[model samples]
Target: MRTNIIRDEHVTVSYDVVNGWTVVEVDGDVDLRTSPMIREAVIRLLGEGHRHFVLDLCFVPFMDSMGLGMVVAITKRIREHGGSLRITYTPGPIVRVFEISGLHATYQIYHSPEEATQRTPSPDGLADWPHSPSVKKGS
Candidate 1:
């Protein structure tokens, strides 16, 4: 894993590439203050031929509308180019926000970065689904 830090006045975006996945672990607040930087970093990785992404939001304290918008925008961009975004290890508060806002339904959420990176495409082969046995029917 290789970590890259993109620091600014209000927030810092730390990312790493492991195996074939680019895991972007975001810290600090992601609001109007820092969404652009985050977007740029993710877009750059996509431009560099990274099709799989794991966004680890375990350390993020807060994410506002701008942050949510950036995520949606990035997801759309990835889909346009036949890519995917997996959010993993997000804290309860952040997870709640995503759930409440319906973003969780639009994106794949995982318990850990490793799990996210290891996920395979769903039956349709266009989206990702949980690999755990818990996802099985009648388990």
Candidate 2:
């Protein structure tokens, strides 16, 4: 899988696609400054017919409310189009936040991008693939 770093400060945003699944990896901190870049990338990918996404945030130092909001918004957009979003390789802090806010239940949390991409969508969902786990979350 190829990876691209878009912006970097105390935080960095990178994205890559593998087997039709776009994997977004966020390193450092994801605060107000870098969240917009992440949002834009996801939107662009969606426009390009990439419905399935795996957001890997294992290296992220922190993610504020805005960052979380962006994720939720992207998930909503994908769902509106009968698509799905999966979050994998998230760090403990981010996972705790998602769990506490009940967002974890709303979005599928996977151990790897491959698993996330292979998940079978619901009856009203878009598509699915054979389960082939290949995503590595943390460093």
Candidate 3:
């Protein structure tokens, strides 16, 4: 039942545990000004012993390379710690960024946080999916 919320003009990061997964929902733009904040929050959580993470980016309207790099770094750090990171609820523009950078394939993405937590238990485990496919409009 641990929950933490951090807010600023550029972004808001909130963390909670859901169904044994650590859910981090981010709202607002993620750019150079905000990505550091996200990194700090996530790193702090990692220090606190959180492993499984679902990052919901549905509310993020825009992101730049810095933001992407921060996410990539976080993912690597989590993996190095024997943890997993799933990105959920990505909006179209962000999805495009992920597609362009081939991060969609690098990261396990889902339509919702619940799905991100539940879907991998399926037998296929996303191995059948393509790498960085173009996101369908309205998806």
Candidate 4:
């Protein structure tokens, strides 16, 4: 069941808990105008004690630099709270933006939401392979 759903003029954000991971699905362009709403939704989830996160971005067709910054900020805050966040995106504008900005290597991105959850390493959903601090920082 969906825990929360937020609808704006340009965006739709919803989330569900699947196998200990909170799957946040975004539908709309993530730009300066819409990033705050998405960020707030995620912060609310984090406040609710949902530690594991998978940002499912297949429905998000466009994301500007502000959107990416919001993601980075969210990830940082999640880690500060001892939580973890990952991303899942289809091959499209969002993926292309990440690639072009070199943020793809900065994030553990999956091609599908199933893969995102399947690769979750623990009940708390923290994985060692990617950017987790427990892992070697830049190896």
The TM-score values for the models, in the order shown, are 0.80, 0.75, 0.81, 0.85
Model 3 Cα shift for residue 9 (angstroms) = 1.6
When 1 and 4 are scored with TM-score, the better candidate is 4
- Candidate 4: 10-residue stretch with minimal lDDT: 130-139
Tens digit of per-residue lDDT, candidate 1, span 1-139? 5666687767777777765667898878889979988999889888888776778887788888899998878877776667656777555678788878876665667777777766553323224422222232111
lDDT of residue 62 for candidate 1: 86
lDDT of 3 by residue, 8-123 (tens): 76678898787667889888988999898898898888899977788888888998999899998887777666676778765689989988988777667787876766533322
lDDT, model 2: 0.67
Over 1-139, each residue of candidate 4 has an lDDT whose tens digit, in order, gives: 8754788789999888887788999989999998988888888888889778889898998999999988888887677667777788887788789888877766767777777776454543344423433322112
Ranking by TM-score: 4, 3, 1, 2
Cα lDDT listed for each candidate: 0.71, 0.67, 0.74, 0.77
Model 2: how far is 46 from its true place, Å? 1.5
| Stretches of model 1 off by over 4 angstroms after superposition | 120-139
Sorting all predicted structures by lDDT, with the top scorer first, yields 4, 3, 1, 2
Name the best candidate (by lDDT): 4
- Clashing residue pairs in candidate 3 are none
Error of 3 at 85 (Å): 0.6
Which prediction has more favorable lDDT, 1 or 4?
4
Give candidate 1's error at residue 85 in angstroms.
0.9
